[model samples]
Target: MIIMPQLSPIDVLKRSNAAWLIRDQWRNILEDAYELVFAGINPYTQDKKAPRSMNRQFDSTATASTVRLANRILNEMTPPFDNWADIKAGALLEMTMDKEQIAALDQQLSGVSKLVNILVNSPTAVSARSAAILDTLISGMGVILGIENPEDDVVPITDQAVSQSEVAIEVNARGEIGGIYRKRKIKVREIKDIWPDAVIPSDLLAKLNEKKDPEIEVLEVTYEGGPGSNVAWYYEVLMCAKGQDPHRMVERTYDVSPWTVFRWMVIPGMPYGPGPVLLGLADIRTANKVVEMILQQAAIAMAGMYLVRDDGVLNPDNIRIAAGGMIPVQYTGGNGGASMVPLGTNREFDLGQLILDQLRTAIKKHLYDGTLPPETGSPRSATEWIQRIKDLNQDLGVGIGMMMADVVQYVRRRVEVLIKRGMVPKISVDQLTTKVEINSPLARAQKLSKVQDVINWLQMANAAAPNAVATVANLEKIVAWISSMMGVPPELLYSEEEKKKIQQNIAAITAAQAQQANAPAPSQAS
Candidate 1:
């Protein structure tokens, strides 16, 4: 069992204020930004019980375009782990170890991998929330948390989406996350479920169980340096439970794990991070509105030919219009009738469409639509496809690296929690110190680039002096290097027995060649 220190209500409030203040400051901007991305409206100023109105009658092109970009990005850059089943596939990660340590390392890693699979495969896994948060992130920014005990499921893979408005983060100069304060309104029932065995007053439990529109409270979890002084990381979590005034519930203290907040890109001068899609958001929104407005105006302009009456009896208000129908009207005075006249025979729509296309092109360029794969048909050849993929990757290379880093850190934290909870074998805990290698396509492409350079050099060397190159270089070592860089599993490489036999054969061949060279003069005498 774990123990946490109890905190007075005032102390809880104090600890929460710092985070709350930061959140309040960014909420207005982030809230609106996220709304624009997901809900297609600006909800920053939405009041209680007031119906929110759309600022512009635009469709979800921004949201759809963002989704398309994210899909392409993820597709081009595969996740390091193929799936939960292959978490220990060995293709994605690297570790330094001797022959003797290999078995132990694999065993330890198996446990950790299984635990990760369990966490990631759960109903509320990161994969489930990734699309939503990713869309929000691209639009402006978004936040996601890998909570240990979400209380919604039994398997404990609790990934939750934190509204951008509720999170405040601080990053160091090196871009490492220094601290994070995430405040959310969790229901009382959820709190009870999360801390199932906590010592809560019976009366409070009774009220909570009644479920009469359960009260929600601000549950703030903060992570910063300090606390467990010698440990690698330490953090604190304080909860202000409903009805527990003046004395808040101390969820935990000195959490030995790191924070699970994932930030896509850090804002230049801001204390928190920013989104990739936010850079061109103003242009996108403007173009979307412009298109919508143009469509509406064109429809109004082309409604039909207007009938003008000199008697003023057949005005727009008195006219009853129907598609493919003729209307009958009686003239009130002699020589008074309606004449069908076109609304705007001179009004042109081609210019409006041109402007619309130009605006869309701006949005497409910023969102990287042109660089991504086309919606229909394949590239002419595999080479062409590869080149296109490489181009797309290069476009977002830095951003991809940032995402990979965050994913590694997030997985590390989850593995640590599993180890602490005894879900994984104790032996595997030491392996957590190893660096995680991202095996995503972009990362693989980088490695492939270096390998290709080496191959090219080898070809050039062979062309210059094939015999000398072959004799001077260790072919086995070269093959091993190339195979390793190509992401071949270590288990699939040549066994020790095969390697020994190959080395012996090479030695025999070299000896025979030397003897033949020495005795060549006698054979040439004939």
Candidate 2:
């Protein structure tokens, strides 16, 4: 119930612009991430007064690693049409629903999940997500603003990628991003189209009447609802004309925030998190500089240098270092002007090459794009394999866990939007009624290690004492849980009642067989 301070449009606008200034403190670091890792992305502050160039990368190692890792995250976390997630009943609601009802719910939710996946995998979404993930890798965080397409019934969601440079975020006390303020230049003519209710200033309208489509700055903000508000966030579009106070163009609220700020790694109490680029920025910069130096060295080596003694024998201006070129020089000491001695130029780059190799390796390590060398020792044992999986899980678990949170939010928010637009059936979706299950490749891998641990424990219990495993674990429920986690279809599983009926029938048959066998022996003796 935290209440936002009441502020006039001018104050809000000034605050939004001030956030940009506050964020500029990280300009150097963010600029390095942009210049070294992704030259195409906007830096923290750009020189609007001058033309810009991109892709000035001297060393491609970090750039290559960044692109590869982004692709890896996309394919593994939100692979297209992979059925990587599901919507199901939450713990509180599961006990209330019967098996048939739960099954029906699953069927309904599956269709909704499918539609959501469609929206997420759309061309616009993929492109936006790809850019966002790349920026997250390079600049620590990325954002995408979801916009609905009212025309298309099948895939009604389109995404617009927001550059980190233009966006400033604030986190709530819960360590979640509660507000986003973004500023960008927009053309005068497009204001009516973008914000139909905008009240254009007299001076700007006067300029527009003169057919001058001047571009002006506009600030867009989405923030948490104040006390006693119902919606998740309030949205407003503001503008500050030249020499005038800022004013609001559009004001509205949303059930879920359209703009999402996703970070690679969070630092508590900080709105923005650090990315892999920050970890390897030093190596990236040093490696690029080293490679630049190597190129310079090579150029110098190719353009041979020589010293001509003050004897004026060899004319320095007449020397041609190219193929088979000769320069006439006065003879001295009976040695055809051997006085023109070539200066010592050592072309061996062993040291530079070694440094570059190590730098590249470090870059890949930081980006999680490195390869392990061949195994020269004994083969890995079962215990070692289990440990290996567990280690990987521990290493990647935090980031992947955070990603899962975003993915769930993304799905739920998009689904809610769909429901609001009548693209989906009318159904109440709240945290208490349903839950999201992530089955993406990396998420499942994280779960796989835990599943293995449970199985290993069960095996140890069985080895220690017969029937002791049953006391420690519900073997049947474990099977069902494992199957669900492993992507097994629910229809293939047996219900508890069906299992009990089968067990009873088996017991009856066994008793009859025992009675028949015992009676047969007595009859044969008679």
Candidate 3:
């Protein structure tokens, strides 16, 4: 038996294209042929005795006639080609051969006939071929018409595919790119990696089980960065819920960008069920409007928290205003004509305490009165309240001088103890006197007798023994003893050369006193 070779896929594809073209030609020919066959004059005249009826039967007859004519034309237009080989050869030649050349056409006629037969013999093959050809032709026509083929409208499909493909491609590219791009690197840096230091650790849920009312809530928030690049970290306290995600209460992180961190914190009824909450946000100078909004929200929330009723209004009696003024006092004593004595201890203390109490009362009154300014009355306003407090503080400073006098007295007692303990030397007495004269105005204003009395006290305390040894060794011992008592290093009292001169002066003074005491006895014998 002779073996029949299987057709290649390319051969099948070509045949499909040819069949599709043939079918299209048939369709066009049939349409034209049917139009011609259906042509007819109206049978009923306008003057017909009975009114002419446009019935469904007449429409059916016309359609049947048209179909029959279409069949005949299609059959004639698409006659069977001979075989697969002939059809294939004809198609190839048709693509390249000039249709205007009679010689080439004559040469290919036999092959063309065989191809037509093959197409006609296999209906299934013919149908598949026709479908493929129709698809291609339709697609081409669509491009020309600027309208895509309904079955193969692949523009949107291709675009979608491309987008998905691009996403994949970018991901892969990023992996292969090694170091991050500068833009991405900067963004990553800006997003600080606080993952290691996150306030809410992974194990927080377990620890949260041990608390009552363990609902986690954020409290204070702060932000850092420049005007446009700020970021925030939120501080929160979590309470245990009766039955919730976490049991033990603790702290958690609420990292956010600076732009709305404050809003997040101060938002009423936020982390917990809606109610008044205190939230401290960063003082953002650039975000003035946002800051104002936050302040208003906070004020409203505070008002709500302290509200006496549900009417969303603060109580008028809650408002208070405290005010005060200062008066400097001078006293005339029996001995002195007049002296500035800022109403000493008793009066100063009493006045200060009274002023502070009054201020507190004013605050209480303002809060109770609910007289906030702009919204309420002048006295209740924050501005007015602040000014009132400021004035009170200023007045309180008047008595501060008397308070300082008590501090000075304590310091003087400590100094006197140090002097008696020989922690300060006698030669330094002149220096000490000068210091007292310069610093103690009260001492300077004392009677001359009182000043002399103080000097006498000093002289008795600091007096040295008569006829004391004045040799270099004795002087050195004295200087060293004084230096030790004063907590000053001996070397600092006198350099090696200066020590010699100090010793000589002490020896001369001692010798002069001895000679005078010895010589005065001989003169008294006469």
Top candidate (lDDT): 2
Alpha-carbon local distance difference test for all models = 0.57, 0.74, 0.27
lDDT string for model 2 (224-285, tens) is: 77556666688888876678667777787777788867787877656666788887889998
Residue 235 lDDT in model 1?
A: 38
Between prediction 2 and prediction 3, the one with superior lDDT is 2
TM-score of each: 0.74, 0.81, 0.13
**Quick one: best TM-score, which candidate?**
2
Positional deviation of residue 372's Cα in model 1 after best superposition, in angstroms: 3.9
The pairs that clash in candidate 2 are none
Residue 299 error, candidate 3, Å: 17
For TM-score, candidate 1 versus 2, the one ahead is: 2
lDDT of each residue in 268-303, candidate 1, tens digit only: 766555565576667766766677767666665656
Lowest summed-lDDT stretch of 10 residues in model 1?
Answer: 84-93
Give the higher-TM-score candidate: 2 or 3: 2
Between prediction 1 and prediction 3, the one with superior lDDT is 1
Worst 10 residues of 2 by lDDT: 323-332
lDDT (Cα, tens digit) per residue for candidate 3, span 179-291? 10000011112211312222444455455534543434321111122123222222222222334432212222222211110010111221111000001001111122333
